[model samples]
Structures are given as C-alpha cells and as structure tokens.
Target: MFKSVDLKLQLVELLISSYANVDLSKVKIIGVQHILETTHSMFRSLYLLGLKPENIAIIGKCYSTCKEVFEEMLDDGIYVDPSSSSYCSHKSYDEWFSLNIENFLTSQIDDLLSGKYEKILVLDDGGKCIKALNKFSINTNLIVAIEQTTSGYEDIRYGCFNFPIINVARSATKLNIESPMIAQAASERLYLSLQRKGLKTNKVLIIGKGAIGNAMKNKFASNMEVVCYDRNQKTYDQAKVELSEIINQFPLILGCTGKISIPFDLHSKISPGTVLASVSS
Candidate 1:
C-alpha cells in the first residue's frame, strides 16, 4: 500500500494528458536519469499517481549519493532493486560506479517487455538510452520517452528518436528558470573556487550566447570582463578576432555550448593553463 501524498499540479496535468486513455494502475516509469531535484520530484509525482515503486526503476548514479532519497523511494514502494540499478555519470566518480550503460538499458527493456508492466515512461536525459530503446521497443506494448536535456532534444529533432518524444527541454517555464539558474549557480561556484585557488577571475570568455550562456555573461559583467563566441557564422563574423585571439590569451575559458565549440584548428593555440569549464555539463 502507498501513502497519500500531494502531487505537484503541473506534473499532474502533464501526466494526465499524456496518459489520457491508459489505465494508471498499469503504468510503469523507467527513469534513466541524472542526480537532480527535478528527478526526485518526478518520482514523487508519479508515485502519487498510483505507479508502484516496484514498477519504476531508476537507472543512474543518482542512487549513489542520495541514499536518503533512494531509501525513501524504496520505503514508499518505488520499484528499485540492488541487482537492477546502475549508477555512473562520469569516470571521475569511478569509486561510486562504472557505467555499463548499454547492458543496463538492455536489461531494463527486457524487464519492461517481460509482461509485468503495461506502459513504460522513459526519462532519457542524455538521449543515448532512448536511441537504445528505439531499437528494442519496435514491437513493444507501450513506451513513452521524454528527453530532458537540450542536447537530447537536438538528437531527437535530428531524427534519432523513433518513439514518441516529449521534449521537456522546450518548455519555456523550465527554460526560463531551472536551466538558467543552474547554469548561473554553477558558474558562480566555479568562479569562486577558481578565485580561491588564486587563479585570475577578472576576464572570462564564454562560448555561445543562449539563455544560460547570456545569463552567465551578464552575471559576470558586473564584476569581471566577459567575452563571447557564437558558432553561427553571422555571429562569428561580428567578432572574428575575439574568438581567435581571446582564446589564446584568456586563462579561463567557459563553455556555454553543450557540444564542443572550440575549433579544432585553434585548439593547439590555446594557452596550456587555460581552463575549459563547461557550466552546462
């Protein structure tokens, strides 16, 4: 038996609309995720909708650090078992997990199709898992995917996605607050830490000028010198020297672009100590 809990209204509406004709009693969500509050909240929202804790399997490193939350999910009846969870985002946290990403997703899909569940909700943050699911879920009963990151959304937009995709990255409200604020907060912490290390923090070169990128630029401009580069030819044309010269001279380089924006031709020219910090990742 599950306890009565309040569901976030926005998530309630989204889930209601998405599951319109489906029986909520038979739904399961396999969240291939990251360690974030939104992820935790999503679990809560789904549980409140009557999804059994045993039907939702979270596959990621989120289970590594957040022991309390993980225990709460289990205690509350969220579908989590030691043999089924895989939790590694980067090799840096090598002690915590070694990501067997392929094997993990394949196992999840196998279980998803083993007749214990009716529908599956995939929260593929990196977009790679959805691509994996696309191959296996071709003849499945029901599987819905939601791409949570801009990079993942781009992959879907470019036709990597075969199943129905709910691009949460495109939501203006989430775009306006969650991403930008996270980027800002991350950059702030990066700057402070570098400054503490006695590194020069006065001048920062930020690549890309999107919402989060622009927010970082503006936040830094009040107290430091900020330079920008956009890969768009038109934008690049406006500041050719800025991208070429500033990269070589600046001791700190901030990557606002999720993908590499540093031209391969210019890579060797950058100063050896120049730090390449990605606020997005």
Candidate 2:
C-alpha cells in the first residue's frame, strides 16, 4: 500500500516528468464517480500523470473514498478534502446531491478565477453543473469533462456550453473506450475465451458500419464465419455483403450499433445455444 507521503512524492515526480516533457501548467482535470472503485481508478491515473491533489476537485456523492485516496497520496498541506460526507453510497439522497454538486463546482470556479488554479477539469455532465459553469463564464484555460453515461454527453453538448469538452465515457464505449490497443485486446481476449469454451466457429453477426464494428469484423472474420448487418448502404456495399443475407444466414450474433435495439428475431431465429455478444458504444 502506498502511504500518504510516498504517493504524494510519486505524484509530484510524475507531474514534474510530464511538465519536463510537455506543458504541465496547461493541464487541469476534474471528474466525478458514482462508484468508489471507478473514482479510485480515475484519481490514480490522474495523480500518476502529475496532477497536484490541490489542483484537482471532485463533486459527487463518494466523498469518503475521495478523502481516503487523496489523504493517502498527499502530504499535510498538499491535499485537501472539502466534502462533508465521509463515505460514498450510491443510494438515494433526495435533492441534496444535486445542490451540493453545484455548490462545489461553483466554488471551484471561483478558485480558478482568483488565480488559484489555471486549468480545470469538470467530471460530471450534469445539466446544472454545466449550466452553472457556463453562466459564470469560468475562465478555465483547459477543461476535461468526464461522464459515464451517454445521456450526460447529450446533456452537455446540447446544454449550450461553449467550452471545448472531452467526455470520458466509462460505462459505454461511445465515450472513453477509444484506444485501438484496448479494443483489440478486448476483442482478442473475448474471442479466445469463447474459443476455449467450445465456441469456435461461432457464427458471429455484427450490426454496424462504424470503426468498432469494422475492427471486430477484421479481427473475428478469419476465425469465425462472420457476417455484418449494417443500415449504411455504403458500408454494406463496401463490405461486399448484403444485410439481409447476413441476417438470414447467421445465428450467433454481436451488436455494435450503439443503439439498444437488437436486429432480427434473436430469440426465435438463433439456435438455443448460440452465443450473442454486443460491442455497442
């Protein structure tokens, strides 16, 4: 376990390394998590990247977890936990959460404008928080937005915030799971795991024309008799395969359309033991 002083030094070293290589003064990050585990991971990554504990702010329900992590990492004056709650429970908390979240973010904005911090990272995609930031016209040089849900992205995008936003969607691929390495590794691991369980030659059906679907198709086509069903006529034409033919021919299916609807009568047409996988955004 990394003690408070050790972690703080590590963070400082990481930041110095980053600054030496790039520009640290230009980077700021903010994030929120509904779960403790997710929050831990996000903070760990950010700290390891050289962000000071004081420069970071979190606004969510899990105050206890944040406190523990930050306290363990930072020295006496380096880190501070301003949340009232000690523990994080995703359980219901009447309207207080929303109010508190807004208050916390608004306060942070004040700190930023007072020259307390240069860069800012907003973690939640909540309408109110985004609106608050926008209304105040916070002079944050850089803003990194992290959200777990697709609805959050829509909220921020359509909420009329003019800032440059980067949404780290953790819950769905449509947000954070973007790296080709992670995608390829996940695909390979899933494919191999399925193969080990006597799922080789599983008729994998994909339903999308996007990059992820294409990557899946390219990776799984050689091993399994893969078929793609896409509404994009251009993609269908380019693939040299018809959607109807693919739907009629394959039973084991994988969906990548980012939409919730599953194409074809999966229950009626697919074999009873057929495997189905969804890699949607």
Candidate 3:
C-alpha cells in the first residue's frame, strides 16, 4: 500500500504461496505497524493460510490523525478481523513507543504464559515489539521476529537477541527495489502538494544523502535544481561545512535523515515563507 499497488499484490501473492508449505497453526502471529493499512493484507493472507482467528493480532501503533482512518477501514471490512486483533492510536510517536507497545505486547505474552500458543512470531516496525520482547523472561516460545525498517534494524542491531531475527531492513530486495520506489513516490507527492499551493521552486535543499535522499535528489533534479548535504560530508569539505550558511538560500528544504537534521537554534536561520518537507516517518 505504501509503494506500487502491483508490487504489494505481488508480495502478498508470494507470501500466500510460501505459507502453503508452512505449519503456522500454533504460531501466534503478532503484527505491528505505524498504520494498519500495510498489515491488513498480511493478516488476511495468514488467515487464508488457515491460521486461526484467535491466534492472529494486527496491532496498529498509529497517530491520532490515523485513528479515524483505521476505524473506517475496519468498518469497511478491508481485512480479516481476527478475534484477538485490536489497535490504539496515540498523539505522539514517543508516547506509543514508551507506553503502549509494551502494554499491548504484555497482553499477548499473558496469553503465551497461559499456554495459548506454542510460539510467537512478530512482524515488527521500528523494532518496538522486539524492544518490548526484551522485557519478558519467557524466551523459549518467542521464536522469530521480522523487522521492517532500517531505523528499526539499527536500533536492535547491537542488542542481545535470544531468538533468530530476519533483518528485512538490510535485505537487498528492500534496499534496491523498495527504497527507490518509495523515495520516488514521496518526491512526487511533495512536489504535487507544493504545486497545489502554487508554491513552485527551482531550488531544493536535501539533507542526508542516503539512499532515499539520493533518489529524491535524482527525482527532483530532473525538473529542478537540487543540493544535498550529509553530516558525514561536512567533516570532509567546505561545501558541506555549515548548513546554517546556506539554510536560508533555498525555498524548499527536505529532510530525509531519520534523525534530527535541523537544530532548534537554526530554526531562526530559515527564511520567511520557506517550505520544509520531511520524508522521514
């Protein structure tokens, strides 16, 4: 749903085909995502594979703005709603991560402790479920986790793991195929949004020259002037010396850095009427 509809359909077909040979009857499937839309088809695929309704849970860790949309999708019966499935949206990302994730996973673990399922399989986003898993002592039944994002992989990479993890974040399929498509979609959306406002700009400043940033730069460069900066490059050359020196020059500034690319004090450096866009979650 995040990328091309064809790609999403192909992945779902692949997963459903592969699930035919697997025994997931006793494996409790727990899914976590920023939005419920991406995980809806996944839960449905598992159900089509004959996984029980009581054994599947697709929990959405979305924001307040998305709560209504989630409810509407459920109302529309967009996906198979298992008996154990539920979701809650918060006002901020930190609130959901620090408080809600562990609480939700704790309820699932309680079921595990009560001998409901032989094993737990997590579909994680942002590594929140894995981070929450570290708190429990019941490691034997927690078999595997699939992490979806690069930021999530980086967060859990140095941590001690008791079970096998599939790092889909670092997978070549995601890096080579998905990232560019996502970046291109993001770039076009931002450009179109600006166009609707009649705020056309020839120059764009892109922060963080990573895969997404580079792809976005290439996309924008086809029609506009684009300049990129990464923190890693600042130490090597004068051209990247200080973002503050050129912060006010560009009418459009895009942040693709996953971390904070602009400081609080530098907010004053941005010119009046400048448009700031973020491609990060």
lDDT of each: 0.66, 0.54, 0.70
Worst 10 residues of 1 by lDDT: 91-100
Model 1 Cα RMSD, 1 decimal: 5.6
- The full ranking of all candidates by TM-score, starting with the best, is 3, 1, 2
Tens digit per residue, CA lDDT, model 2, 216-271: 77777777777666765624535765454445456466776545435444346555
How would you encode candidate 3's per-residue C-alpha lDDT over 33-125 as one tens digit per residue? 644445544555666676765676555643322554355445544322222223334334454354666666666667666666677887787
In model 2, the Cα lDDT at residue 70 comes to 53
107-196: candidate 1 lDDT, tens digit per residue? 676677677667677877657667766766544447788888786676668775556788887799667887667767877799788879
For model 3, state the Cα shift of residue 94 in Å. 2.9
Cα distance off (Å), candidate 3, residue 128? 2.7
Query: What pairs collide in candidate 2?
Result: 4-72, 15-50, 29-121, 30-121, 31-123, 64-86
Q: Which segments of model 3 are wrong by more than 4 Å?
A: 1-8, 63-65, 72-92, 232-240
Name the 10 consecutive residues with the lowest summed lDDT in model 2.
72-81
lDDT of model 1 at residue 98? 27
Clashes of each: 4, 6, 0
Q: Which stretches of model 2 miss by more than 4 angstroms?
A: 1-18, 21-28, 32-50, 54-116, 123-159, 166-179, 195-197, 231-249, 259-272
CA RMSD for every model?
5.6, 8.3, 4.6
Top lDDT: which candidate number?
3
